[model samples]
Target chain A: MKPAMLYKLVILIGILITGVADAAAHTIIVHPSLKVKNISQALQQAHNGDTILVKQGRYAVANLGIDKSVTLLGEGYPVLDGQMKGDVLIVNVNHVIIKGFHICNTNKGSLRNYAGIRCESVKNIIIENNRFNNTLFPVYLPKTSHSVVRNNVINGSSHENTTAMESGSGIYLWYASDILVDGNSVSGQRDGIYFEFSNGCTVSNNRCKNNYRYGLHFMFSDSNTYIKNIFSDNGAGVAVMYSGHIIMLQNRFEYNWGPAAYGLLLKEINDSRISDNIFGHNTTGIYMESCSRNQFSGNNFNMNGWALNILSDCTGNRFDHNNFTGNTFDVSTNGSPEQNSFDANYWDKYAGYDLNKDGIGDIPYYPVSLYSKIVENIPYAITLFRSFVVSLLDKAERAIPSLIPVSVIDHHPLMQQYRKS
Target chain B: MLKIAKYTVYDIARNKIILSYAIFLLVISLSLFMLDNDPSRSLSSLMSVMLIVIPLVGIIFSTIFIYNNSEFIELLVAQPVKRSYILLADYLGVAGSLSLAYLIGMALPVTIYAPGTTGLYLIVTGIALTFIFTSIAFFCAVISRDKARGIGMALLLWFFFSVVYDGLLMGFLFLFNDYPLEKPVLFFTMFNPIDLARITVMMKMDIAALMGYTGAVYRDFFGTSIGMVFTLILLAIWAVIPLIIAVQIFRKKDL
Candidate 1:
């Protein structure tokens, strides 16, 4: 090749490479005061990988749909009003980014899919730093995958509005996968974070309080990780049902008290890990039914009505290295001869001392008693929990190990408390 | 009366303030609609617009429209026409013009973008809110002797309807948390026009999940044919009550 031609070819290759790189990452600015008259037109004109930056102003428009890989950003509280028509914003594309906008006043129609921001079948989307105010539903993801929803403030104050007919949620994911919801403050809605039929998701570092419904509710969502989240003053702290391979770690479940309140309620869950969580001031700390092979460790059960309520059919579970302190009832199990093991836990009511200084109790502790077993079957018997007859019967049952499960005793119980810090 | 209505519409069309508002709305609405690719996403964006801009235009335009049109009102009163005619004409004129402006500015973009019942509902809501606020401004103008006080009252009314009413309802719920007043709560919500508007539009949108159980009860009660009638009746009251009060005050006023 000629020397000049070779140099030109090299330059052409460099230009092509740069063009490809630029196509992968593009930037678009939406001036706060640019005052564009049509949002649809602007979106239609935008390229697949471009970013739309919206400045601080009220943008009154109708339903917006996202179908391409793009980033939409709002600066200084740019408002997106739905005019009470339908779902405000819907995302149908992959790798899209939405941040920093006040989204509100969504219309709650009987046929509408999601109210605030609905993502359908999209993947690898990021929604962050946004404020959803007075919307019916804040962030809804259906059949989407690999999405990160973080650092968002979702407020749904439907206190006096009778016009809203649907249940509102701060972040609702259904049939989604590989989702991560973290560091969000959600209040005054139905469910703060709800997952149904979702798998392989992580919910962590989120503050979900004062919601009318559950703080974190999952049904048939398997292989999910929940860590370091706070669920306080909601109708229920957390509910896990028909799920497996779930990990619940370092979370705090508090102040979820009502006629039917629980810190954590597990129904038909199997092969899960529940560890390092703090449960306080709930009606029941952990209510389990038909859950098998789940390991419970290093958790603090404090000031709950029943620290552990293991119903019949819950088998092969392990409770170890946990601290049960100041709970109204340590453990209540239905039926005889439980299949689960309770070991190495620090019980506030432990009578045996660790004379050998091995950090393990000398005597095996029977967490379940005949009185508790009776109360489990006839719940009204709980009113006589502190009565002399019940205490005497409980002591007798613990010493004898007759009606309750023989294997339910905490062998090698911890003499010293296990604290997360 | 018809001439006054026509002039009011023409004057608002020519007014620089309204023109700016129309342009601003056009720009923002268009940007929001175009930038969003999902219809549902745009619905949320439009909701933010409605909550902020609807009350803003309703209060600001109505206040200024009343204040600036004081001379025109006085001139009309000086003529031999009925005071009721003058007030009605003024109301129709201002409301019609602003509604027209709102329609042209917002309706066009919404129709082009969504082109569904939702867009049409929004246009109707915007127009309804404009008329409702105009009537409220007339009432304020008739009651207050000073223009400043009148504007102040109008703004306060807007604030109450938009923000404070919801707050007060929450306070009530908190105070009476022990009592189950779900049915009564539905009845109570009907008194606020903003709540009425929210309910009416939401039912149309089919996203009742946002409403919760109480909202569902209300929907069941009011989403029926009878409920539709009741809603229309309430909306009529929203229009008629303020106009009637304004007319009554205008008829006897010394001005």
Candidate 2:
């Protein structure tokens, strides 16, 4: 066939598919208005390309496996109480939509992966605007793609039990691709939003707080974008590990404090961009180990215990145009063969004069202090942090630079806070 | 010994240098507190001054004071007073006077402006530095007969503690920079009193961030109770050993 004929044939196929959908689609209402009393009965009576509209009522249901090209629409936020038996709903087929339901109390299932709603091996679906309570692995999507999980509220496992840290996550995505998880509020789970082996995903505008472990944990997930998310008061804010090509923008990581806790732990991540994030009150903000070629720009590190704990072996990472205010130590590194760049950041500890008035500082700022280096090797020496000797040593070193990673220099430090354009 | 120590303290208390030292401390603390809006920055400013100035004054003042009052010391020695008593009295006199000045000059301002652990830490470290340095001064003064050489020795001691020691540590670290030196460096810090004093305060200030994982490891070793006790005992040793050496020298000296 000619090129034009092939295009016409593709359009004809698209029209035929839509026509078949329109022809087979039916609306099945499960309510007192009809003879059907329960959703299961309505579902049994429905066919492919059907819409099962459930009315407002308490429905005590068993495991629901949806395997059709259907839409399950709930009216007035109908409650689906599982009474602690098994997964409330499971979607085994593709091209499905489940919206506007309140689901709760999914009990122990056989696979140890029983979820409130599990989408297994499904494609082209949308699970939106639902509220979940006490559901392990709520909105679990395994091997899914080209789907959306938006505007949902998940009040996952109770935080009262300390062992809740081992429970399931709020929205778990494994082996998923091109998924957009947006505008969700999740709390009280092992992790609020998790992505494992998921790629090309956009996790944006989520409020994940007070979780048992990490609010957002990304592992082996590549080419993802996380923007405008607030992760706070969790055991740790987020852990992005063994991944690359990540763009983290405009996120707020706050108040994640503990001996082992941190705002963001980036390990073995390469060619990533972390920009415009606010890191506040975290024990260690942005702890990087073995990460390379990452760009950190326009971030605000405020009142954190340790703003940047960039360990040894991290190289080619660029820290530029960030504002460091009131952190205990703005930057720390183990003395090793390392190469990284710190440029044009506004440091509160900068004592250099901008005599030329070009908005950039005339002199460079050494983010690593002398005493910090001493304490790095001799941990007990931190007790002497406030001592005059350490202060003078740091000042003296700052004046006549030596020993402490001279390669990591803020060559063009900003006199003012760097405002992102 | 107590009576002589009391009289010496009173006598040194009235001296112009003691008064000026107190006044200088007062002015610096008050000015630093007033100048920086951030309480932490001001605390840092006060701490550095306390570290550098306190140790220097303790050594210089005690050496000069003891040497200038050699006639008085000889007069006391000529009396029925025990040899140990006279030396102990002069040492107590200088250390007590300096300690009082530091407490009066620093403690009040710190309590008023930046109270809590910060104030308490600064005061404690200031007191330790004072006691340690004065004892060192006493040892240097009693060990050497020439006043000028003694003063030179004291100044050199101050310079070594305050500057050269750190430079040397930096050099040692550079020589062995390739190895994992956290443990060895920590052991090395205990040898220097100034380094010891500095680390104790920094740990308290929670700038452990600077230390990173090394800091956490330090905290694990120190904890709260054990760390403070360790610091106090180390400081006590620093004070007592010097004074004992001074007493030994004083016993054998021909005044």
Candidate 3:
């Protein structure tokens, strides 16, 4: 036979085998008020590639261990109460899907192992459309890969008497990779979504609000894409620490106000891309500390206390094609000889003209004033920020561009405002 | 006084609402223990939930308990029993019952799942909150003539203890972020019940590294036996001061 005919024969055989396997797949229905005494038993009876339908009922089962490649679907909020026995559900199998269940009441253990649903060392898992209500550690993925967690609602209404020192994340991913968390709602937890030592993940289209701590917190996680998410009313917004190759795009960060709160906090991070994001009503729009080689473009920084707070040790970062309007301060820098560049941005404070009609201002706009640098070293100097002496000094510094770094000025700033709506 | 205390305990113990609350807590605590993959993670989750829920339940349950028993209190006051004894009995009875319920609801689950100093710390915190909120509820009852006002006062007290007190402390820290006010702030934070709870749990967990400079300062001063004793004393004061004030007000207030 010819080579093409041999390839066609191989494909035909593969299709037939897969067709037979698909026919063998089973469907198990767990109806509301089903009198199944043991959830584990229901899971045990399910076959590989089976679908277990759990329909609206309260299942007070603790530790429903799932070790099979099966789909568990819940209809109308089937409640799984752990009763503090251990993790509510432990998924230890590949290609397992858990969807649409209200999980609550995770037990407080000493070793920090309690979770509403724990995926340990699993692959190709899908956890979607679930509700973790009043749970301690709601959804924990440790040492897992290629998982998707989507459209889930995780709420942690922690009380003083019941709380333990180690217990509070809504969704925690540690040492995991290639995961996608999308379209979820998390609130009132210590950290809404925590990523530690995880890499190559995507977090998009999620709403995290009113969390006790950070809405999205990552430490030592790299090559992650966070896009189109809404983070609001949290203690702090998205915090990227000690990571690299991060892409933050089109995300809405607002109302994360406190002493050290910020819309996006970059600490010891490098080589990231942050573009097309909306940051408003936060204590600080973007705070960079010890970060380098990052690019920020097409972002809207509005109504924030400080549009950008660049601490010492940040270098080679570029801010261009962004809109900075209605902010208390356009930029606050700590160190002199700023290594970063701010060009082509639309600043509301800019008074420069486009005399040539080239859409670029004739004169450069200095973002970091001498007064801002003084306030960085001595914050109390902020008290005299609007004083005549400080104003004269700022004017002198702008005219000469001596005290502040020359590169920090937006040389080709846009004459017209860029409205991001 | 002892008879009244016994009667209050019996009434709380027999109430279906308290029973359901205890049962609900049991279910939740047990589920939490079962759900967590590691024991330490579960402990932290429990601690977080306890921080918010315990104070809410303590204040609400005590306030409602006091208000609901107003008729019974009037009946007892009509007898020869002194109001002071009656008030003390009511406070003790309410505190004891709530603490007992918490023990059954939360403490047993922590012990079974967490099983360490952290669990013991959680139990102590639960008991402390029960006593503190019970005292605060009695104070509210003594100060306010109307039930709605009394309940509102209890809720405000809860709000102050839970959220506003922390906000004020944070504001002070931000205002004085440049200063080295760690030692004085440590003493100041001890006055707030929520801060005390936070400090106690942080001390037990040995996870002070997460709290930044504040934890470092706390570990520096409060890592010793002297610090522990001071914290315990402050916690004791937190429970006692409100009770003493409530007793004083109850002695003077007309029924």
Compare the candidates by lDDT and give the number of the best one.
Answer: 2
* DockQ, cand. 3: 0.01
Show the lowest summed lDDT stretch of 10 residues, model 1 chain A.
A380-389
Which has the greatest TM-score? 2
Q: Who is ahead in lDDT, 1 or 2? A: 2
Quote the positional error of residue B28 for candidate 3 in Å. Answer: 64
- Please identify model 3 stretches exceeding 4 Å from their true place: A1-23, A31-37, A158-166, A385-389, A419-421, B1-255
Candidate 1 local lDDT, B1-255, one digit each (tens): 899888888888777777777788888888887875655446545754675576667766776777788788899889999999988998888787777777777888888888876677667767777778778878887898888898888888887886676556655654665676565567666777766666566555532221222334555665677986787778778878999999998899888
Q: Is candidate 1 or candidate 3 better by TM-score?
A: 3
For each predicted model, how many residue pairs clash, with residues at least 3 apart or on different chains? 70, 12, 69
Candidate with more favorable, higher TM-score: 1 or 2: 2
Could you give candidate 1's per-residue lDDT for residues A116-230 as a string of tens digits? 8899988999999999877777899999999999999988765464332455778989999999999999988878898899999999899999887788888999999999999
lDDT of 1: 0.77
Runs in model 1 with CA error above 4 Å? Answer: A1-28, A31-35, A161-165, A385-393, A400-403, A419-421, B1-255
Candidate 3 lDDT (Cα, 0 to 1): 0.79
Residue-level lDDT tens digits of model 3 in A99-180 = 8899988887567768999999999999999989777788899999999999999878656543324457778999999999
Kindly list the per-residue Cα lDDT of model 3 for residues B1-255, writing each as its tens digit: 888999999999888777776787798888877865556556655766677777777778887888889889888888998888988999889888888888889898888888887688778877887787788788887788888998898889887776676556555655776887666577666767766776677566533121222444565555567887777777788888888998888778777
